[model samples]
Target chain A: MKNNYDILVIGGGPAGALAAKTAADAGNSVCLIEKRPAIGTPVRCAEGIGKELLKEFIKPDPRWIAADIERARIISPNGTAISLEQDKAGNEVGYVLDRKIFDRELVWQAAEAGADVIVKTRATAPIMENGAVRGAKVLSVGTPADIRAEVVIAADGTEAQFARRAGLDTVVPLREMMSCAQYLMTDIDIDAGSTDFYLGNEIAPEGYLWVFPKGDRTANVGIGISGRKSRDGSRAKDYLDRFVAKNFPNGKTIEAIAGGVPVCRPLACTVADGLMVAGDAARVVDPITGGGIGNAMLTGRLAAQVASECIAAGNCSKEALMPYDAGWRASKMGTILERNYKVKEYFVTLDDAKLNTLAESIAQSSLKEFSVLALIKELITRNPKMLLELKALRDTLS
Target chain B: MSTMLRINRDKCGYCGTCVAVCPEDALELIDAYLSLERECIACGICARACPLGALEVVHEE
Candidate 1:
């Protein structure tokens, strides 16, 4: 293994792998380090990604998809369910992936692009030189090693320590962070082509529970709640357990996982001298949906693109990496993410009654013309007092 | 002495998120269970990250 490289990427998820691949393909010596022995074990994501966003990078390979999602059903506390066809014009549509295979394939692509892939290599900390990140201190197979790099990309997922180590204000407040718990269950009846979302404080305080079909009779069922609201010590697993017992009483649990999801805006500063933060470490996840796989890949590519340019110019300073930051903010994702954060901040504050009202309104409205604006209009029309929140929602959606 | 981080194997789901969030690098999943190592500073991240509430910090008075 090389002790030095042009680009060193931490974490081996979608972002890190793509970053390594992009940089390496540009002829830079790149290395990707993953703490897990395997690329994707103990899967933490719900695995749903938008087709439009994903198509920009890699074509969807059938080997990675577990189910072709055709629609999404939103159920309110009052039991009113609103169904949205995934094929609706201008709507986002995609698949629920077999993340283990998908993640491994991504890293494999990175290796194919000439990036050295090292698994079971835990990045302990950012190696700082003159107050700037230059590489990482790693623990690979119980041996401490220092890998130096001209540029470092941190894609460390939800447990993001790398960016913080590099002086980025990456702290996600409890309210903005989503505590998630999920169960991979089988022998459960579900719409094999549709995803289901249950919304209610009783269901999941300040968040939603999702049932994403992996295939016939199997799904990844999970719940995410605002961490602050979970201060009562009621675990997300408890809510998930109750939801599962009620919805799929006889369902068998195949696997269970838990983690934090940063449902917030992107970091103000994701770049420092010779350092760039991508993926969950940079809080690129959609604030409203808690979906990030697509965004992570997008940011990874952009980060690497700018990093490669800087390396070529022989100036990997913070100012040189500003293009990555500017590039991300200029993209369509940048617009949506900036708006989604505000949407999430306000949406999570709505009480169960308000959510029930919103859901009921959407359910009663015409499905063909239904839109985010329509839902907000319906809510504001029903309750004039909801004008402020509705306006904020309108601002976000527009 | 600080509080000791305790892991209840029965409640643990073996997510390994606790190991990831432990700043002290004191946690690991071995044989489908979480094993606490000597480096534990009991910073409480693992306790918070444990989805099933399987970990606890018991301070000895």
Candidate 2:
């Protein structure tokens, strides 16, 4: 085994790609590895990003724009609909994207910035020298090889392999994780600019249903139920299909995707000696909704900044990289993600009637004035619904 | 070819995602643990979907 890289990023997802690109842009040699031969194969996400939050790194290229970015529709438990338009003023969200293309585009940026990407390379183990991780022992395309670097970043999504091997505590409690499933259908009757949100346990117990319209009558219809309740004999995809079957009689199913969303906050420690974690790997995902794209990209950029700073000082130790944690927390990404996690637990525990009433109450409110916190407070403000539910939400949350 | 899944049984919440993604029908949920009884090819499909780090395939020595 011989050392050759300044930065080695494992996994070619958003976080890995961004770290490689940013480090390369800073003139550090980077080696980016993906376990799969192709960059982004077998998509596992709903492929949605808040376009407003994407300016942290590079400008939004027209090629990266998946569909019309704009407002969303809120459907109450009783099925009351309330619409919000950007013209009326609300948070701007992007439409469903072709994740395969979006992932490849990020890789292209890394390559242009001077990083070498090797696909089908599985980083099976960390290469530790003197109790400090130097790089990795990779099984590249079925052949064993040692690829070394000064700093190694694991961006392997929610199931972070490198993080676990480096002896970091990588766990997102089952109750906080969302068991999500999706169906891609065509000829769907949904507006391209409006994302449809269905929240109420009766509709999709312990979770919500989403319709991400991508024009051409095609959309990603999905549901995400909390893992705690989902395991108790409920199928999220079944609920999603029932919703689809009831609503879009004329639509045709094209594809299906299933996965879990980490609705937990960033890990207590995301960096160790010569090793760092980013994106979904560190659980830097949203707590309110189980979304990770905006947050993942944000972490990617922040990790890259820290790596660059480390290289300039010729020290990529864990302590040298702690500033990345501080800087990221200072950004809105940390506050919103951690707070949203607490907020999600509250909604996940609500029953059918309570959720429905909460939905209806929220639908009745003005869109611009309706925050996620407002919906929870309206649902269980005066009425102490369940001691366990409240305890589950408020406990263990800082 | 069983998934040869090793679970930190304490961490298993029986989410059943590993069972759903198992192309080989190698896993089943019992007492909040995903039991790997049948042949598991170590495909890793189940491992990726397990959010709690409960399921993994250990190759035979």
Candidate 3:
């Protein structure tokens, strides 16, 4: 790896890869580093993305697309299933990806765009100059090196150490952190074209369990619960184990993965002098669904674009990078994130009986468009008891 | 006696869930190896957050 570059991106997830590619495409010298030896291994995500959203960055390829989801089913505590077809389902459901191959493909594209890709390189700390992030102190394959750059993009996933070292408070609140566990199982019966979500306090407190098909009879069975709800004997894994035992007793698990997803608000500030943060590092994951792949890519591309503009103008100060933060918050994704956070807060407060009532109400009605707003409207019309609470939520949005 | 945190490397997936929930910023994952920094207070938050039951807090005399 070089000691100096125009831009340095920490982490090799979708965020860093997109940033590197975007910056390099703008004729800027960029280098991307991954702490792991490979581009994507030990996959931490459920690997689901909206079809149109995926097309915004990269075209969907059969090589990376594991399953083409045609329907989404939400199962309540009382086994009430509310299904939405592909056309009616909002932009959240479309494809179940094979992230192992998908992430590598993104990095490959970044390399093809002339960005230097380095693996097994960990950024231990930020190199700060007069309260400004100059670059990072990285350990590349056991050999420590100080890599300097005009701008540093901190796309380093959930750990977010680089941003914190650069004087950003990247700590997630315990209550907002979603402790998650997932298993890739085969020899299980599943709807090959449908994604299933199980919602109930017993199944996953303040969170939900999902069954996402990955072709054949194999699927990704996962659960995410609030960190505050996690305990020694009743942790996320314990909950998942119980569900799997009862539902897929004969299934064989090929791979198991565990991680944390931040369901809190995004960072108050995503940029500092000579530094920018993107993707999960910025905590832009949807609070309700815990989905972030598209958001990460969006922020990554925007950060690079803004960084390139600042570099061209010979100014990389925090003021110059402020546009990156403002740009995302002004976008549709940002508005949706804010709305979803409120929705999640409201739903988590509901008990099983309330959830069952809402599910039954939703099951009876056919939504023309399966969006959060439509669902809320339906709930208001059917359940008069929830009118006040739902109306208050709607007022906050307006 | 003192309270200490222990990590079972065999069970640990090194997925960084502990690192994320660590309010003290005590846990660091270098590649596949998870390490505890000097900031660790042995609060056991990481232990509870660990999905694999890889982390534990114990009292030793």
Candidate 4:
């Protein structure tokens, strides 16, 4: 079967649609495909997106907002606490989003930009031709038909079949990935503008649990743990359920969803011949927070801009697409994401005693500089061994 | 009425796990992304595997 397009973008998610919109806006004919018939369904996200980050890509629209949050509180294993004080001005953690509405808006933007979108259609594989990605072969009726594109953007998320088919080997170690499960619950009498985080091995081993309020007495409550730690030990939902049952037993769960997150650095290579990957497939989620919506959208825009460039120049090789790679790392989002991964790795390894000591110190410290990084440095002062291990990671700081 | 699931492109991760675990092969990885072919019975297994929390299943309303 002959397949062809100026640009054939697979996966209509944030990355793919953005790629399509951007390319279309740039005067490239584009096709945006989706396997689902509707735009946003299933509700896998916690819906907590930083307001500041979203403002960078597109205007913040109320249609996509579920709730606005202001403060963040962290709870230790024994419930010891440390928080960024809140006075109700919306300072710390920001919005709890309406993921469904937000996704539709993006796709609509793409369509408005002139990309053709087809729902309930899935691309089966990258149609490899002469070792250069030309397009994809989709299964329309148990029969494979190829759709050719000068360039293919695999906004396909973490399990990248396009790159894999193209023979690009980039795997996030299981230990570096976080398994996540979340519940949208209602009737919880908690602070509407505050988000809570619970850290420490006793509560989450290699990860943490979060309660992000979403107004109307509802909240997105979830937990994630390093894959290696939770793979055989506890299912993500089980961990979340145990915690919720223990803490928010009276809170009624309205919906449940489970998934995984990549907290590692970006893949060693984000582009291959005729293709570029973005979002989760590229492991762009924040290492410490396990958040990716902002990054996914940002990376999607970057990928689209790069794809358009690739089409105009008629070259889609690694050399031509180097700007996407360089620019992404240079972006603040990239810097913070990589830095947080290091912080997460370092923080997860700290024991309860170390945690308690660190929390106590943060609670009482007023001698000088008050950056979170500075406090971590203070904790390391009491434990030189930790300093040695963290020294290499200290370079991980941007 | 024939049914189709819609993926809000903004919310999709083209992970083919939908195709991988789809018994009907309704979901397939195309161009390193996902699309539904004629075989889609609307089983949502592929939506489950996305780590980015991007996949969704919608009915033709």
Please report the candidate that would top TM-score against the real structure.
3
Candidate 1, position A286, lDDT = 88
In model 2, the clashing pairs are B1-B39, B1-B40, B2-B39, B2-B40, B3-B40
Segments in model 3 whose C-alpha atoms lie over 4 Å from true places: A87-92
Stretches of candidate 1 off by over 4 Å are: A87-92, A231-233, A366-385, B1-4, B13-49
- Give one digit per residue, the lDDT tens place, for model 1 in B11-55: 887765565455555665542456875478876666765667888
Top candidate on DockQ is 3
lDDT of 1 by residue, A174-272 (tens): 567777899999999999998888999899988999999999999999989876666425778888988888989999998888877887778898899
Between prediction 1 and prediction 2, the one with superior lDDT is 1
Model 4 Cα lDDT, one tens digit per residue, A244-330: 888888999887765567677887877777888788777788887778888888887898798788778878887788788788988
Q: lDDT of all predictions, in order shown?
A: 0.82, 0.73, 0.90, 0.71
Per-candidate interface DockQ score? 0.32, 0.08, 0.73, 0.07
TM-score head-to-head 2 vs 3, winner: 3
TM-score of the second chain in candidate 3: 0.93
Candidate 4: which stretches are off by over 4 Å? A1-3, A86-92, A141-143, A231-233, A364-395, B1-61
The residue-level lDDT of candidate 3 at A122 comes to 97
Question: How far does residue A185 in candidate 2 sit from its true spot (Å)?
Answer: 0.8
Ranking by DockQ: 3, 1, 2, 4
Q: Of the candidates numbered 2 and 4, which has the greater DockQ value? A: 2
Tens-digit lDDT string for candidate 2 (A228-253)? 65532355655776788899988988
In candidate 2 the C-alpha lDDT for residue A126 amounts to 94
Please tell me how candidate 1 rates in CAPRI terms: acceptable
